[model samples]
Target: MPISSPRPPPLLMNLSLRSADRVSYCADMASKLAMDKRLDDFVMILESNGSDLSVLVGLLDARMVSAGICGLICEGRVGEVVRVFRLVEGLGIGAFELCDELVKAVLGLELRRLVEEGELGEVEVEVEVRRVRERLKRQVVRSVEHGGVEPTAGFIRR
Candidate 1:
């Protein structure tokens, strides 16, 4: 019989599992850290006594989304990511507050990959960059139309 190569795992399956694991792990860690810092303070103030794992999990999920969004915003560029983060800090978006650190980490990894591949200026990547920029523009317009402006870099009159 002729020898044959084994099939590799599907890309979708690999991505789905990896993303799920990362989100779950990050959320759990963030919740635990938050509780450690706030437990005594909450008790002193007579607030809720115990932490809710469900809520923490939800926050983590939110963090994952925020990180993804920020990654898209910067087109996976490291310098751009840092600039956007500083802009985000200035804008004071509540969403940014929760995921700023996570977003920076994700963007940093993506940027490193781009550098390693030596394909930062490739046409395909440029398409992706343009798509992200369009989405951001739409989001900004929608926010303005809805009378709710998300705090972002360049949102304020300088």
Candidate 2:
């Protein structure tokens, strides 16, 4: 007899929101959706995915009003959400930290663009660079304190 492979899991559809307002609206809809008996089945399916339930919490934070709605949608089934939250909290913090890095990258790119376009004189460029560096240093320090990440030697070197 041939060995059989396990079937693949079902794909979950990502709820799409066109705008921030839509997030709130959808969350309300999710609350209504939760009242259905099917919700329990959905929760079971979600749990099987091994996804960090914290992602749902992060989504709730991302759409503040939606948090309660999400809880309701889960039919007050919080165990999976709690488990996912613990798993995803660190990743969420890292992602939050990366937002600052993204701002720095954008600023650096803009500065480079200005130089390439001859829109900034060398002296102005130097001054702007210094200013940006100082601002970044202050921001990095604040981020380190806020995020509880030690300033890395590489970051200090830069």
Candidate 3:
């Protein structure tokens, strides 16, 4: 007699299917928001992830992957962004878009910093952006044990 594999419990199967449905719904909506370039709304939908990174991964679409990257970058989550990039960059166009958005975001952030801090120079901003570009180009990264990007210590979240 051939051995048969045990089936999953009905309750477990139903729960798993429901969870997948939820992730799909969130992913579709998040992709739409990303296409619309609604970064804040994209991030808002992210809070619905309930701290589950997998749900967040489903929310990423290559063409608009930058939307997710930008939103999280604004949230100061460099490590998380890198982790996601590692998973999805091979799907695209995504790596290029991610780099472009990273530059734009860094410039925006630097400009905002200049406003409050009142003494930053363009050269400094340029250097920082260049550093980030070089790092990404190298695919070299280091994440903090506490779930943040290393070296900069500016990985803040609001």
Candidate 4:
């Protein structure tokens, strides 16, 4: 009897993605990169603090806290803003001071826009922006003082 040759290994098939699929894949990659860009900048900020921030960086990746902050800011939700500030504070960053400075920048831009359009007087815009900023600061301070934030599990090493 003639010896039978071993069955040939199955051929590996190449994925023949359609043009639509290729376009979708590219869009997905672009979105992911955009999200990562923010996190990369956040990491750099943390690293500048003159300590081994690798642990915080790793925790941030696990918790995606920055994404939550971005979402809250985009929605302009008042209540969630305190929680976002607390998250930053819990990570050993000075959230209150940073938020104070950021709010000024935001209001400055808004004030400039209002002046350009003649929608409101400079005094009115300044008063309103300052009022809102102070309220936000108080809320954030209360949250931090009261330990309102439930610590993220990423901070607790196994």
Candidate 5:
């Protein structure tokens, strides 16, 4: 279970991240801390609201929604993950949102044990280091407007 740094720490500035980038950066940092098994470090940063924010932007609101949630997943806090996920899902901040990343993180953190114990087959865990680009073909257009995201099962519980 090894993952390398994909998006490196941002260069220093007064406020390096804005909008959803802030949360995305923090979540990436949380993933790194989780990979390194550094719970204390991440908790301290969260407690202080990005106090030791990966040596980038040390202090800011930073949203940190993703970091807090990712930390819970890494720490095996399943109940809290669902609780928090439902809350953040309604926020509607366009960029760096959790819809896709949540799926990947959950798969990464939860499936490792099954794979290691020989219950599940090998999966693509080395996603951070693999960066392949492909050229695109000619464009095609189709318009089938649909509802936004289908509400998760969590919404039904309401």
Candidate 6:
């Protein structure tokens, strides 16, 4: 018989220690969607995802896949979302940050939609959204500089 090595304790065990304060990311995202009516367009885009995700990804930009996930998470349908993060890990998309980017993209898309709909005055919306995006960029840069979180990767760049 071959000798087998003993395994270390599971990381999930460590995660369990924080279980009480562990908010479901999906639930938190859903709350944001509730507050942002503009996210409706992104929701519709996500609701359109069908059985073949790969095919859909090919037809649309790869970012749409992330958008779709945000849509599901925002809708509180966590069960329906694919666990792509697990597959992409080590290829370098930190799970936490992927969710962050997806949510950010959803918000961006919503803001754009609102401007197009004239719900927001075009010039005012453009300036405000640009400012908010710049602020978010600076915050992300600070997070990277502080090593607070790893920058995400593994996305198919368009």
Give each model's whole-structure lDDT: 0.49, 0.42, 0.56, 0.46, 0.43, 0.46
| Model 3 residue 99 distance off true place after TM-score fit, in angstroms | 8.2
Q: Each model's TM-score, in the order given?
A: 0.25, 0.21, 0.34, 0.24, 0.25, 0.22
lDDT of 6 by residue, 1-158 (tens): 99999765864433454422223322233334433432343233333333432232233333434555666656644323322333334234343443447666555666566567875465455556756887878887888899886666332568
**lDDT per residue, candidate 1, 57-145, as tens digits?**
35454444454455454554444434434433433334345454766566666766876898655634665676688788988888877
**Poorest lDDT segment (10 consecutive residues) of candidate 1:** 41-50
**What digit string (tens of lDDT, one per residue) describes model 4 on residues 50-91?**
343433333333223434344444544323344434445656
Which candidate achieves the best TM-score against the true structure? 3
Per-residue lDDT, model 3, residue 106, is 64
Q: Per the 3 Å backbone cut-off, how many clashing residue pairs does candidate 3 have?
A: 0
lDDT by residue for model 3 (46-98), tens: 55666454555644674565555566666655444444444344333243443
Clashes of each: 0, 3, 0, 0, 0, 0
After superposition, the stretches of candidate 6 with alpha carbons farther than 4 Å from their true spots are 1-120, 153-158
lDDT of 2 at 146: 92
Choose the strongest candidate by lDDT: 3
CA shift of 117, model 5, Å: 9.2
Instruction: Report clash pairs, candidate 5.
Output: none
| Alpha-carbon runs more than 4 Å astray in model 1 | 1-64, 67-98, 123-158
For residues 1-158, write the lDDT of model 5, one tens digit per residue. 88976775544531566735655566556545533435445444344433343333333223454455555666655444443333333333232343347645664667676567764432232221221211111111111123333334123453
Candidate 1 vs candidate 2: the lDDT winner is: 1
Cα TM-score of candidate 6: 0.22
Q: Where does candidate 5 stray beyond 4 Å?
A: 1-64, 92-103, 111-158
Predicted structure 1, TM vs. truth:
0.25
Candidate 3 similarity to native, TM-score: 0.34
